[model samples]
Target: MQTSQQIVGQFRRKRLFIAAMVAVLVLVLTLSFRFFEEKSRIEQQSRDFANHTIARFDRMFSPLDVSANNTQALVGLRCGEVRFPLIENLASLQTVRAILLVDHGNIYCSSIYGERAISFSEAYPELAISSQRMLLTTDNYLLKGSPVLMLWTPKTLDNHSGLIQVINIELMSNYLLEPTLPWVERAVFNVGGKSLEYGNPLIEEALPSADEVSYEESSLRYPFSITLFGPPPARLALMTLPSQLPLALLLSMLTSYIVWLATANRMSMAWQISYGLTAKEFMVYCQPIINASSGNCDGIELLLRWHNARQGWIPPDVFIPLAERQNLIAPLTRFVITEMVAHLPVMPRCKSFHVAINVAASHFRDRAILDDLQTLWWPANPVPQLVVELTERDALPVVDQRVISHLHKVGVQLAIDDFGTGHSSLSYLKTLQPDVLKIDKMFTAAIGTDAINATVTDMVISLAQRLNISLVAEGVETEEQANYLRERGVDRLQGYFYARPMPLGDFPAWMDRHLAHIAA
Candidate 1:
């Protein structure tokens, strides 16, 4: 008996793997949701900020309400001759880097940091009056300390051209984004040749060349943006803020997977042992098919018996399904095929000798399946006469055609195991034209004992003869059943009456005893 540590370790490993898978799923879902939420929040904040800023500019220009501001009025206001509250109020904000007033192809006043007031036309040579709609425009441009936003509004008075106020605002680094950034860490802009002045080098050159900057820590992000005075400048630059949450989440996911994988790997070997299937540890048993003429045993149907390391003598009925579900059927069938092939070189000296192996219908439909078996068969020491047996039920139409055609081409004989039970067998037999028809033991064993079985057996045998299909009786348990099948012209037979499947080593001795008896 295996120790509890050996037994329980395997189970624990499997569960832990399941737990790990669950954790990965959770991590993915969590990140996806957080990403969606963060993206949505950033967009919403941008919308709200744009709406508020634009509304303030719109209110200032509403009072002007005119198509033009005459040069006299503009010059009077700029030269301290007349007081215009709208222009003065906007210019007074210290964050404003410069203010320019333009009217009717001429400049009125230009102030840079409110220190040097000059004429706009004289200061800039390219100062031709632009026909472009330049009423209340807000945008960002790079400057020394930070990005500066310039808002342009054409102040109009009574349908005449008025001065255009260029209100330059130093872009606030932390406006709507301060809540998302760290306490000590500040958001900075990267100026890849676009030239934005921030205190740190990283912020000055973080992004190669993009207009917006967003820095992330874990699932959270802080956004910093720059707007050009005109249409959003196509070229861009970026930068980031310092944070640690992103690193933590990534490390946690990696550590969780590695630990789970290592533990799961160590546990799998024990699990296989606890529920293991070994060819050597299996018993090869046979059921007899009785002969039509002599009424004695004709052949043995080879069945595998697995003795589990934990549970003794696990039945095929219980484990075959498990094997298929676990994708172990291919390996298991290969084992059985190898063992049976070894039987080919050695068989009893019976008048007729053949061994039947039950196969899942899935194999019959697999063309490559027979080819795979051929590869295994050619090298191994040969076995006695072999019958490639398949169940009548699982074979589907398309699979049936491919399997039957392939089987015939390979010169391998096919027999439908447990024949007459499936309603579709008669039709399948007509098309497939297999070499042998196996009578279900129900019909053979129930003769005279079960009235319906006797009639069914006689009809099935007659049908087999009519179709030129060889008939064999399976699951024959008694001398009476053997005699009954022989009377009814059952061609081959197997049951407990014939020697049950002895071990491969024991089989030779059993055959020698029978030969000795026949010789005597």
Candidate 2:
């Protein structure tokens, strides 16, 4: 048996928990997407860098290849002439380390040792007279006791002559090796099964596994590839993490707060309605219902009002529907009855002066309301006149003949409120046979206006007259409207034209003033 407060509290907690979970889910997805996006961007950058470096190498060395071809053609036409000026000019070039001219399996001319003949076959067995194609080699040649890259171009002029262009390995290494991006820990350059490397010494010393290499690209024009190694994917993701963390958190909180704001009203109303009965925020106000013909106040209709310390004022139209939807209407109606009974002593003594209290459809379904009314009315020597007003806005529950019969037996009166506004107004009127018919304010507002609404008002007056039912025209704000209803034999008028709904503390004074005005 959970109380309304407990149930409402539980529901609020559940909804807040769901909102938090949704926010967490959104944050997780955002971070995951950012991680992959950053990874893809870094990988693309690495590829671009590799391609640019390889293109740069081709641009740097293309001139050297052309020069080697020119040198071979010159030596072939000259038949290996020992020209000092020709060898001196070629050797003076910055990029050329040494040049050797070989003829008939023997070294004949040299830029470093002019006319110093050496056996080419004995000095370099790797160079064969039969090989006559241009070839580039990277190997440790003992001639300089260091690694060297040789461009060998063979020619035939009378006898076989070979032009050898020797380039120091250090020059090529400097051209190919440079520091890359911060994330790129190392860069490896491989050619003809031989390898060279540059970049962070720590990373070069302890090479990453093949699986750990982030990006690898090979030269499109040469027999070499560049492989880049960096921190693992996980580490790369972490390096870029802090930059996106704040934005992710902001998005998560913004979404969650919007959700909370959207539902804050409903949850607040639930709390107010749950504790309202005990906190005494719920109070009844009254508006005088005047006899249209006599110009005298006949009775007051009770209207519910809520004044919360925190929320200020909550109108009945807003909270009443909520209460009905939540099944809290029964308790609210009971509280109203109890409050009316407490105010019985202050009510006017005139028998004709009645107090009308609106009842919800839920009240008619059970005998509890009947029992409560009986207990409250039993003690009065002459119980105050009471009117039970049922609105047609909601359909009546299954006819509780027992409750209806008991109400009639106890000298209580019933009236249909807000007539013609509900889906089954006529059906309710025919079945319940209430003592009074209160025309809805929408029709009353149209009085003395257009032909259509005037005709509608006339017809309602005619219907009430024929059925012998007391008629009350509501919302008669203007003199023209009030006069029209009075002339049409409207039994009672209840609206702002007569008086606004007043607090109970002010109702008695207002009633006295109205009575005196009528007497005058």
Please give the lDDT score for candidate 2.
0.72
lDDT of 2 by residue, 1-520 (tens): 3344544575578669867987898788888889988877777777777888788766655666676666664453332364564466566556666777777777676666666567866665555543423223433333444445555666664335677777664565556666465667667665544455663221122356754665668767555566777766556876887899899999988887887776676556566687888799899888889999898888889888888665567667767877887778877887777777777777788789888888887777768668767666555554457888887767766667567667778778888888877777667667777788899898998876678877877987898899898998888898888888888899999999889998877887897888899889
Error of 2 at 328 (Å): 1.3
Over the full model, what C-alpha lDDT does candidate 1 score relative to the true structure? 0.54
Residue 155, candidate 2: alpha-carbon lDDT: 69
Tens-digit lDDT track of model 1 for 288-376: 45455754445667787777654465566556654554456566677777776666556664435666777776655456457656787
Q: Which stretches of candidate 1 lie over 4 Å from their true place?
A: 1-275, 278-280, 287-290, 295-298, 348-352, 380-383, 518-520
* Candidates' C-alpha lDDT: 0.54, 0.72
Q: Number of the top candidate by lDDT?
A: 2
Clash pairs, candidate 2, are none
Question: TM-score for model 1?
Answer: 0.46
